[model samples]
Target: MRRRLPAVLALPVAASVLALAAGPAAAQVETTPVPAPGNPGAPPASAPASPQPLGHAVGDAGTGLAVIRVLPNSTPTKAILPGAADKLPKQAAVELGFGLASAQANSEAYLAYEKSIAQASPGGIAVQGSSPQAPGSLAQTAPPNNEAPLTGGINPPSTPLDTLVKVGALNGSVSANWSDALGPCVDTISDASTSIASISALNAIPTLPGGKDLTGAFDAPNLDEAADNAVVEQLKNLAGPLSTLGGILGGQGSAGGGSVLSLPNTLSARSVVKLVDIPGSPNKAVQSTSTLQVAALKLLAGTPFEISINVVSQPTLQVTSTGDAATSAVQYTAPVLEVTQGGKSLGRLDAANPKLDIPISLPLPGADDLPGLGDLGKLPIVGNLLGDGSPLRDALSKDLQKLDLGVLRLAVAGLNQTGAAATQPFKGYQLGATARMVDLQVLPTEALGLPNLPSALAQVSLGEQVARAYAPEGGVVCGTASAPQAPPAPAPQGSATPQLAYTNAAYHSVPLFWTGTAMLLFGVVLVAALPTRRRKTTD
Candidate 1:
């Protein structure tokens, strides 16, 4: 009967090279011209000549700095074999050279080994061989034949292979376990597979021993081969939309949010008046003029707009006085036109028409015969005080400087209101204006109830309304001759009667009904959409 082997009993044999091939096979025999032991085949060809000993003078000079003699049991001395003095010195030099060369070679070998190990073990090394030294350490115990057993056993030992397999299995197991633990974490990374591939490629190339030259190693073709492999691995394992999602989220975190508003022109209060000439008047011409005064105008949006009007025909005149002759003084007079706005008026005589009057005044000279002194005749204090430059002149000049009103027509539009019913109310009405020569056209509303509506309408309408209501009454009106002058107030006993102030006609009541209804609807929708939360369990 045939005897069957259990898997465990066979594992030791099966896992090892011994099970595959019987010990010390005939093929292991060597058939080469081997070097003799005592001679070691004339010294290795690359060995150099021994350094000469220093002479007396040189030795004395080098006493402290130079190595006089190696200690008896030091590493270098013990490394030499006994009874081989003449050959020992040469052998020692050869061994020293061999050691240096071997170290460099070993450093390169170790780097390659480490790289191989990292690639094979994605997790890490699980088990290492008993010796920390590299595989080269076993070479000393082996026969001249390269097929010698590493552990010197009749049958090759299974320990090294077993350790290697165990390490490989452990690495695989750890990698799998770690993947399970970190599955959620991978979702958060934008390029998880690419990052893993990069790390693996970095770890594959081993670290060289300290002081070894590494510059040439990086240039080796093997490094490029390994990098290509890593790239292939990364491409194969790309995560589906996670990479895109992560990039989008990252970008959003870098930018923020706000609101911006741009208005066509600033809104302000102004005074306006229209003068129309009656046809066939004795003055011999039909003419019309619109005057406006803008005051205390705070800018609500951007730069304020400016307009100017030309008075078609007016003549210039000069005034002068002649005195110093005993008992006789000559005074000069000139005709002046009055311009008024908001109860403030100025009279100017000898103002040259067809010229742009900025409606502003400047300082005047003491000489009454000054050329432009005639122009000053239309100005407030300048015309009234004649030859004097008084405090009133300064005050009026300041007020005029602040009056920056563009032409009334330029700032407003002429809508065809002729057909509008006299009794109709203009609720929610919109207005627009255009200054064709100035190349500016603003439509207050193309659509109602838009966010920009309030601002647009205010730009055109606010100034127009203020101008219409507040322009000063030009000529005085007298009621029937018998109408008595308003009675003078009696002296106050303790305090005088409070004056009744006129209410502004522009102020209107806002419609609160529609606003409240819209707000209620919004609140209802918001409440309906909110998620309902359940209460926690008592247990």
Candidate 2:
């Protein structure tokens, strides 16, 4: 209609315009980076003897945790950056460690040491008893397995931690292994050591006499100095706990097989616990900084660290009992233990994470939903994708796609961007948690070389409950538990003081006896030094 402006005429003009636009950039000469020549005198090098990290106490516990958390996934997120930020992925992580520790220099240990029981018992009773009413529940609830607190008094010990937690479902793990040594530590290098390269690395490391690696913690950026101090103290105080953890993880006492147990095993009641690795929507998060155990502390040797072999969770763990609870007059009960993961797909740490996301029904609820999802407006993801479809189908399609995290965000812009949309749920920046019942039984009856505290035991109780409750639904599977029935009441009344059912007494008892004897001698000296004759004359 407009005098046929030669359709072909536009091509030359466009080519000319493109050439002009690209001329300057194309005219520039290409340049390649020239690598500097290597010196022939430079000795052939491979790598450091100990591949070290430049870290924190538990900060190092993550093991390969840094590899997964430090890098941002290659995906689009709501908090996405414009340039380099987008190129480098973003993520966040928090650690929750449940350490069973005792005081470093416990005085009560002496009393328990010198004081003898009527019988010799080792290993607390496993908390398993038949529910008088239910047979299958026999393993579920048992009285014979019940164990009492190591320290007995009006007030029991409690854990020494202050905790904070949140929730999100993601792939994570719940592990238990004390013997597993932490990554090799450098004695010459402190957490503050700035010189990454060190020839003294090997000489810096001390020989592990106990076949255990005792080293300083990794250098971490966010960890506070006080927290580091606490970690060191925990290492010292909880040496016994660490060893116990090692044993449990190693399945030492179990005549059967292993100690690391997980839940929903879906297997026989008999078997060593396995590593339960599965994607769970716990959305559960927990954190702690407390390490004080009763009147004593358990930190020493910088901090505690351990390793792992990915294993499945075995619900049934073997409990080694020395004798009958009725005879010992001491019993124990199983406290609820759980692990979970959860998260709200919020944009970034700078913004609040999304808690609940409800997909919209079609009929075009709004422009935000699927294509022609509602009567509100056209989303046009595929250019009026459902231009001729039914509203019901549109709504159904929108909802179905949501099951996939990737589609959910696009279908609705409100979704949080922390999670990776891969097929696996655990593939995102989400939360992981562990829970255990903090009872005296869980604490080693024998302090080993460390001070034992009953107070700290109670403190960990809540943490265990929290970990156990870390469910996909974001609520405790088993609500807060009642006080454990362990260290049970005498099923048969006998006035004899129940003997302690613990091993390694002889090895750990020396220090206690030495301390007790020293006090006894001091008392004798004071009594003998008194002059009775002088007092009579003065009266």
Candidate 3:
């Protein structure tokens, strides 16, 4: 029961981890959630203008941090035999495959450029195992350059950008993005922000004891983030007579009036543990224990010893001001551990009930005597010779005392226990952590009084992932004088000079209709008097 305290205490630790992993903060330092996107308040447009510029950019454009953690070979296995120094496999070949990085982009105009190359590098251990095997189970040959420069402004990736690598017993990708986390202050109207990270380990040797030889036995832990964006627009006011005349001339208002656009980003993230598929529990973490089977000795005859766990961590940030946010709280789900024996259940342990103690009786029946000694005390002649007064009967009985055959003990911590990072923007420093997801121990065959049992069937420890993420803090400044302003509104039509219609030669112009009538009459008279015999001959 005393061994269960760690399981009971995993709740609070898990809670903090979830809080750290919850998406980007909604607001940053000195910043409030802007009215949903383009909806600036009516007061900002009509209210008296402040002598000061809209907002000034302040502080450094904070740094970006990322990491992938795997325990070292020196770490002891979950289960240790009485005198054996079993250690994890050496991981000399595992190189930092673009999983670690630190980068910065200045929000100020003079320093407006970006810097990703100088900081990006391969970092942190990438695999967890405790076998004496040399060179470890994972290895990478000719790792590619881990750095990739950014285009489209100094914006960190708003979407996940990843570098992939694959080698013996290792395959996966690492990614991160902080698009607009530090917006350009060159203009006050363009605000955008988001910071997130993700990691996917698709294939690696299982961290569980006796898990190496089991075909298809592996662990995959993944982290992912999703972001929501809102766009905002700021427009300059159009007033005064000149502005009205421009409207009349079909021209946009004064030469420099227009709207500024901004996108404020929000995010949500989830940490996922994808391992063996557990029965009746979809998406939960699981490990297969097939390598510990000893069919000849009837030890763990249960062909498939499956251990399942439930753990999830989500971290959330609450923005306090522009370009600044901090982890506020976390959502925690109690962790649970369940074990299945040869198709049958041994028992389970969870936050609510943190105790799991079960005993397995020896498979051999009618074997009351020690394996090396016969039932000498029970023989009629021997019993008489080694009477109650003698030490032979008493000693023999004590040596044959029954021993528990095998037992299972398990402890599971929330995903938070796996790893965490703490940020100190003021100090420009970050701290990292590494922890275990699960701890499991099963009685070895030697514990069953079988000293000559093969080491394969003597697993002592089984556990899962450890991880971390980190970045130095930064500040943001909004540009004032150099910031671009909105363009003028277009001029309205139909205001041309009205006098042009009234200024015509004032009624002095001839009435063409009367003149045409007089001409027609004259022509008729001439034709009647001088040309009377025009068509008579033809008739």
Candidate 4:
């Protein structure tokens, strides 16, 4: 009983692993909940003829910020097991990188501008000043320049009176108009900067574990990834142009214009991180098994952690957009999800009613070489005696089981999915992120005495509509394969059947053990009874 204590104690660890695994898996979650602010009350239309201009570009503009989170576990987890998971490790791949950025509407007043870009291009602007550009004939009639030879102290012909008025009128008009417009333009720039900073601060915020304190400029998101994912589809369509622009502007996009147009620009955002120590809990009942250890640092999504993250994005109202006012809309499309193998789309995820399943794979350590089993086996009497019931095997199994490699790997996978980014409003300085979905599964080839494969995902909603999600054939979104596939049911003609997943649970063979016990008992009874007397015994 004493010898088996370790295994008995470790049994809970295994159960906890299963329980944790079976625990509901959370979906791709937004780390930052955009802070809800009482609007900084919209600036008055036009300040009473002041030197400074009014609200930025009064042609109708708005600002927004989305706060996503950084997965601090990304780097360390990757180091532990490389290529086993993807936190969307790379992007800026297509048009999809920039959008699916949901306009989370809080009040009815702000809903209208949720999807609208802050810088208004045009849909009939309201300008109160004269045209800064002079008209072709009367506006720009500069008298012809006459080159005349100059004598030592003599000058050429007297200036024409008509030319003087024309020049004076044009100059006066231009100077006055520009002066008035200058203030507003500067105000607009200031507004844009404030918006950028606010968004950046919101997206890359840090917090205590389990999101405690929540101290930041942003809020904890009640947002969904599906909705956000849906928004991304529109973005992917523009990948062609973005990729093209990158080429024209020179591929080094991380440094201002050098990489402004580049595709797949990586963004890392680490700052104000400190060495944290974590105490390990061996089990719920028996919590601290190890001493305090250094903890992993956290990073917020969309902030710059590396110099390479420098991207070129600038906001402007220089060019007015021309569009039909009749074409105004309040509708926006979201991204879709799909599963593909060899570039062939197998099926699509329902955007309206989205469901995502991620497989959490953990590489299990094999029983290849036992440290002392070989030496013990070589011993004379002990080797033969300890054949199948080796204590060493039992101890090793307990130790190996206690390590919980799978669970650790699962944590890493979750971290890899830590951060995600939206294309800044104007593709500004903070352009893209290296974040991606943590899809690589590290599965152990063999079972580690688990009762049933635990469900690896929490049932958290990723508060956004999605266009398409790429997944494996069986939509095991967040757990290891627990069972085998069952035979397909017959379906009606031409209709695609829903892809269903099935897993087999490990169970004890109660009936088989009972039946064997009964047989042995019967044989013992017969031997004791001695139905007939033996030949040597007198009958």
Candidate 5:
């Protein structure tokens, strides 16, 4: 009986062992960050500012952005802000920062002036992580803080950063106010700024019943419990007859080991939030955008139950204001949900609804269908045990629980407040962009001929983002009540035409009129006298 145990129990032992090894290991988030797209810290490309006189330019704009990506079982790497001009200097367990009225000099004059008054004061903060729990990869920051040095041409920009942990999330972000007073009179001011952030695997899958965080993801313990609940005992009773069949199959009866879900090869979220205070004009404009792309969800590693899924989402907003009249436009998009069963497709689900319910069925082998157990049904005790309605089949059905396919959720929203001095009565309008994707309750399980197997072996999520951006009212402006005007140039010497000198004389029209009247009177008298003589002779 002892020698027969190993061979008889091989199938159950192997299945249970495979379930135990299906869980994913704790690993650092890996990322391949790319350069941010579109105009960073500037207005949208679709809309360009209209032409205006040089010194009359005036505008206020801002944006905020962030990014986080988690990759397991790979080398720890740094996450970069897509459009930032600089990179992180070094790796630290933990980094924290804070700042105040820090600004960069963007104009030639301001840059030169900054050199004269600029003293390196402690305007920013930095702290490194040293503790074991601190992975030295975590980072955090507040307003005015920067992950890298300023480009030295704008108001000190605010750039904050954070790291990904077990929950699989991190953030990279930047924002700033840039204003330059240039030209000889320093009357010209140009301003522009923006902000954004990105995240990965937004959150964790919820823990479910049966002490299984992920359904069939790591089922070693669950399988053991099921075995203890009479599964192994029932299998042993029938193993003696099926041993030959199990051997003929060459140990291929159990579902292959490993996770059920694949990692996101292309999970990413990007946002373009930028503002511009029109130079030489009271008009201001801003645009906000949020985009998310998730690679197909590939399931059922090393099995026929493998499948795939693709998700999509996007939101946008644009606004322009004349400081008294505001105008705006908005756009949004929804996604489609598709499910696949093994090599076959299950078609699409109702996208408007979030709940999902799908059933699975597989063909089972009959008593005579067993390769080595063809005549087993003809035996006495064994025939009864192997016949229809047997306890072994019941035990297998009772132990193989339903698979939890998990949920994928996406959300997006946009906000644009136009600046209107009359009704809105705000110096600066607020612009916001937000997008997020969440995956929860993922436990991939599928029924085989007997017990259950993981439906897929892949990573749960690709990446995530929480879009939050803003553009404040005022920036660097002159202290004067009204804008100063440029002085006129002096007249040149030795010009082509000489100027006429002023003369002290009576009004020309009055003098000429009186002289002409006196002459007329004298001439009339002489003509009358001479004409009288002539008229008398003619009469």
Candidate 6:
């Protein structure tokens, strides 16, 4: 009976499968091509073309990379120490690099010293070693022993003598360390002065006097007397200050009881002894030489010396104008003067002729005309000597004529190329020129009765003016252009736009129009894969 029932069930299942298989064959089918509408004969519109890739284009203008090279225009008036001038330019080139290296070394040395002291201290130990008691540990270990007197440690180590000697040598090398440090400092100072002087000489502009005869002051009868008095006063003032400085450096007296040598006075025996006793006096030898040089310069200009002025000929002042371009013009005027130094009235010397072409860039400031005037003003009675409209200004103005200078163009070429256009940039500039007087009347106003005053004033003023003028011009020429180049024309309308191609066969093909289908399929698959829990079996 059971076998008969199984046969009956199998028969029904087989019949149902056969019926389902035959049903699909009877379904409808259509395969013929469909006909097109009215525009079927028309040609397909041409596709848009892709844009061409343009290469990089560069514009020509100020490149923002400029080189400034300042050539020496004249031999330096101040004599440099032997080999010093030759080394100056080279030293400046490497100054910053050398300074950085020195600073790094100094820092390392300081750090090493600190580490050594820490290592030598009582409780300090190597990181790798097991430390004894860490002050408040619950373990309660025994304190570290005396460290066996550091047999090979830095503190009385096996190499103690050698280490100590090395340390001593390093300590004694303070002078060497200081020398290395000061070298860059001095180079900076010298370079700064040279650059300043150069710029001043280049940009000097001559200022004209108002109604006063620029040359009359030199011809005054009391010029010699005034110069002598000025020198004496300067010498006296210098003596007191120098004495104070010498005493301080020599460690002689805290209350100042030393005889300092005056500018005009010869070096005293006592001063020589005191100077010899000073530890670092040799470094200051140049200062003494400079002082003597200053005195010499002053003496040559007639201060502290009796000098008579002889008018060789009245100066001839000429002015001319030239068209700089079609719309702009520049005018140049020069005043030429010829005068003799001695009482005898001699013809103008040929040496002074060249200076006539140089123009006065600017009048000397009143403060610079009087020697020790700045210091004198601080004193009670001496302050009265430098009152306004004093002889110092008149004397200085008169001396200016002796320089025989007028304005002359300073042609700068190298500057235009390096500034903003070249690779190596110029940080600063320098200028120099040789100046001679036709009769010494073209000298600066300070020179007339002040002795060497004209040269000093010229040195300071010429450098200042020239530097200020050229620095800006050089900056403009070197700076980057104000505007950037325009971009190329927008890419032509494209046929096939470039895009990232992705393969999407295995993954449901996410067509441009079927993004929604892909998202729906992904959510359905995720939900169907989740496990459904069955009810717990109950006994």
Highest-TM-score candidate? 5
Please tell me which model should have the higher lDDT, number 5 or number 6: 5
Candidate 1 global CA lDDT score: 0.17
- Candidate 5 lDDT, tens digit per residue, 1-539? 01011222223212211111112111100111223546788653332133211221122111112112122122222445663423433322222211111111121121222210111111122122121111111111111122332212112232332111111222222222222222111211111122112122212211211121122333334445553333233323332212111111112222132123443343333333333455664533333334444545543323323345554333222233222223333333434456555334455533355434332221122334444333422211210122222323343344422222222222122122322232121243332222223222232332111233222211232222222222224322222233445568988878578676647555477889999999999999988888343444553
lDDT of 6 by residue, 1-539 (tens): 01011222222212211111011110001111223445977766432242211111000000000011111112222224876655432110100000000000011111111100000110111111111211100010001111111111111122322200111000000001111212111211000000000000101111212111222223322446554444334323321221122111111221222111111211100000000011322211000000000110001121111122222322211111110112111111122323222332222323233332222222222333554344322111110012221333344444521121122212111111111211211222211111111111123333233222222111110100000000111111111223334568998786887786767565544464488878899999999999998999989
Q: What would the per-residue lDDT of candidate 4 be over residues 1-539, giving only the tens digit for each residue? A: 01011222222211211111111122111122344545767553331333332211111111111112222222221224566546323211100011111101011111112111111000010011111211111010001111221111101122231111101110000000111322211111111111011111111011111121112211213324443342223222221212111111111211112211111221111000001111241111100000000111111111111111111121111101111112111112222334332223323333342332222121112222455443221111110112122433353454421111121111111211111222222110110111112121122212222222222211111111111011111111121223345559976798688876645332346767898999999999999988776577666
Report the C-alpha lDDT of model 1 over 1-539, residue by residue, as the tens digit: 00112222222211111111111111111111223456656654332233211100000000000000101111121224575544332111110000000000000111111100000011111011111111111111100111211121111123322211111111000000001111111111000000011000000001111111222222323235554343223222221111111011111111111001111221111111111222332111101111122221111111111121122222111111011112111111211233322234332213242111222112222222343444332222212232123333444454322111111111211211101111111111111111100001122222111121222110111111100000001211111123235568986697777887759643333446667888999999999999999999996
Worst 10 residues of 3 by lDDT: 227-236
lDDT of 3 by residue, 1-539 (tens): 01011222223222222222222221112111224335555343232232222222221111112222223232343436663535433322221221212212112222112211012112222232211211111111001112322211112222221211121111112212122332322211111121222222211111222211212221111211110000000001111111111111111232322111000111111121111222342221111010010011111111111122322322121111212124212222333445443334445556555545434222122233445344422211111112112323354465533223334334443333221232332222121222222333333323222223322211111122122222223322222334344558978777876654555664545666678879999999888889445555653
TM-score of each: 0.12, 0.14, 0.28, 0.18, 0.34, 0.17
* 2 versus 4: better TM-score goes to: 4
| Alpha carbon deviation, residue 51, candidate 5 (Å) | 23
Winner by TM-score between candidate 6 and candidate 1: 6
RMSD of each: 58.5, 36.6, 29.6, 43.2, 25.2, 37.3
Cα distance off (Å), candidate 6, residue 283: 60
Residue 124, model 3: lDDT of 26
**Where in model 5 is the C-alpha error above 4 Å?**
1-177, 182-260, 276-282, 300-303, 311-330, 347-351, 357-433, 443-463, 469-539
User: What's the candidate order when arranged by decreasing TM-score?
Assistant: 5, 3, 4, 6, 2, 1
lDDT for each candidate structure:
0.17, 0.19, 0.24, 0.19, 0.27, 0.18
Candidate 2, residue 116: lDDT: 10
Q: Which run of 10 residues does model 6 get worst, by summed lDDT?
A: 95-104
